[model samples]
Target: MQTPRPKTRRTFIKNAALGLTAASVLPRTFAKESPQPDMSLSYQDLPQWRGFNFLDFFVPNPAHARVKTPEEHFKWMRDWGFDFVRIPMAYPYFLDIDYSKDITPEEVYKFSEEKIAHVDRIVEAANKYGLHVSLNLHRAPGYCINAGFQEPYNLWKDQDALDAFCHHWELWAKRYKGISPDLISFDLLNEPSLREDMNDQHGKREAVPAETYHRVAKAAVDRIRSIAPNHLIVADGNSGGHVAVPELADLKIGQSCRGYWPFNISHHKAPWVYKDPTGLPPPKWPDGPEANREALIKFYQPWFDLKESGVGVHCGECGCYKETPHDVFLSWFGDVLSVLAERGIGFGLWEMTGDFGFLNSGRSDVDYEDWYGYKLDRKLLNLLQSV
Candidate 1:
């Protein structure tokens, strides 16, 4: 990635102007002013929250190859009118150094002071920028969404894995106990999409039903609340945050939903999403907005019920791949954002930079310019700002 340019006064003004333009044409659903919904979860009772996931350069252990430091990232996000940052992290960075082929429960449960300090640095930066930090475990002990890969333990089934996972959360809760929930929150796992048919390397089907996820998540929540009772915990609704987990409603934790409905449009030709896009038909918005809306309403009905029951509902990950036509992407994005905002729900775009970000997502059809040392996707940025 190229070094991002410094944000200058001229750039800020230009961006602000673009945002104002978008605000003028924003869908009516999000245009109306409404009070934010009250939350039953005491820790999340804050103002309307909006931000993007910052996953750039967050790879496996010793992650220092990013284009910007945590402080720089948070500062930029805050200055751009964002109030939240979802930091999706891989766990290897926090694991013990002595581990080899076989990772023990000790290794899984242990956390290096250096790694904890690294996270602390991010949290401190978030505070400096007045941005809430949602620390997320994209890859956990025994399961991940990535296909054709397996972890040492299956978090949904193995007691050791579940215990280790809970212990890790416990450690985090203890570390950030005194911090206000306004400053920091924990997103226990990311995109828990397990397939009942898929087999792990050891030939075991690592299938996790909704009940299993509820159990593990409840246990983790219990562990966290044991110390930091007010800690805000979020669990990814299964299948990329699109599927609802009603079983988790009783847990009294927040649920992170996905906005990537009609995946062919959101993930169009994205390599990670499909091995072959040749067969996919082109997508158009408003072509079936009603159907799309119905799908979203149905998929999110349970979550809405949970919200009605007082649980906090949030769309933690939602964005279309850059390769999709810009107009189509915007049309789809507008609908999703409108739905979320109308419901007084909080959301964050999948990423702030790189493959699925607001800036420099490598869309071939779009023109770009350097802003803050990164290629600025002005239109997309404006659309995000408008909502």
Candidate 2:
């Protein structure tokens, strides 16, 4: 049976703090005025923000080894020395009814309710553990960058879809206003790809204009900030961190930043997506560290050079696929950690336990104890400890 969505009246309280005071209000348990840094603070000023990506929530299923409650996730994250959790969510998953073909009004309302509850539980859990959390709209309410999402990227063209997207963020700002200083960041959207002039050989007609995408993103960002001031708002650069918004750059949203990292080696045999499908032979441990480090640094230089306000850099998602050799994966991580250490940039591993997770998701025959036992990966943990 599908899990029922949390009840709104029982779960959400109306007076939650948001807007400009979002980062200002702290829980009674923590100091209220302790020079708490905003997103705009220099990376050096706020040095304790080690983080990890919390998957499974968006891609929930019985087949996945599901953790029963939010508390379970927090306990594991805290024990592993993670200070922050980036919860990536897909709005489509929460729809009351399937609308993969055509969305309906009823599905929209149900989705909004489900999303609010999902955010509420996650933020509450983060606060319970005193961990910072960044809410990421991984797949916007109606669309995604992945091929699995309905094709032609209709989000840019459909008015209802765009409105539903903006409404979700506004509601979030209201629902999670004064939860905790630890709950201070919002990722506007995941990687959004748009092309202005493209060939459609079958139709013999040019596709729709690319300006629509720019307009949609700009509107969404503006709407979110207007209602939820003082929160660190992150805008994803185009795929591979290729695009930037001068207007957003000027906002200096302090915490608004970009993400980039080496995916080729890390995702060599990744099943979901890959740069090269023939699978570049996996690297050997300890020896491949230098090359991996070079790739990460080179890929991140553009964002590093941006001098705009509130524009910090983060490697939001990076990890080797589970299918790759364990020793090689560990080596790649070691190199990445070393580079992040030198640059003072923060990063969140792609997931906790799945195809790209640090822990085995039990789908494969790989022995977690023998390959990534706690002791064997101590150096990697220590690197996170340094953060």
TM-score of each candidate structure, all chains considered together:
0.80, 0.71
Q: Among these predicted structures, which one has the highest TM-score? A: 1
Superposed Cα RMSD, model 1? 15.3
Candidate 2, 52-139: lDDT as tens digits: 7776456522223246344776776788777778877766555444544544533443433433455566666776787778788776
lDDT of 1 by residue, 276-358 (tens): 77877778876654556666666567767767777777888889887889888987788788777777787888888876786
lDDT to native, each model? 0.70, 0.55
Per-residue lDDT for 212 in model 1? 80
Q: What lDDT would candidate 2 get against the real structure? A: 0.55
What is the Cα root-mean-square deviation between model 2 and the actual structure? Answer: 9.5
